[model samples]
Target: MPHLEEHVSLRPYNTFGLAVQARYFARFTSAEVLRQLLALPEV
Candidate 1:
């Protein structure tokens, strides 16, 4: 599984720098990894 980042800020990813936050975030390199993340209950 990919490393999960908690309380991630959305500013860097957004077109406009908005100060929003995410409870959990992960970066997947493959469809399998994405599926694994989707399978988690927290997701």
Candidate 2:
């Protein structure tokens, strides 16, 4: 599996000073949306 860092960076955009950011980030209002995102190949 590809490492998350390979696709994302936290050096500039991260406000919390975390070591990394999600290569792909999303917010879901419901379970169905979460499932859909999880099913995407790019994710």
Choose the strongest candidate by TM-score.
1
Cα lDDT of model 2 by residue, 1-43, tens digit: 2222235666567677777756675657777777777787877
Give lDDT for model 2. 0.62
lDDT of 1 by residue, 9-29 (tens): 989999999999999999999
TM-score of 1: 0.82
Candidate 1: where are CA atoms >4 Å away?
none
**Alpha-carbon deviation at 7 in model 2, angstroms:** 7.3
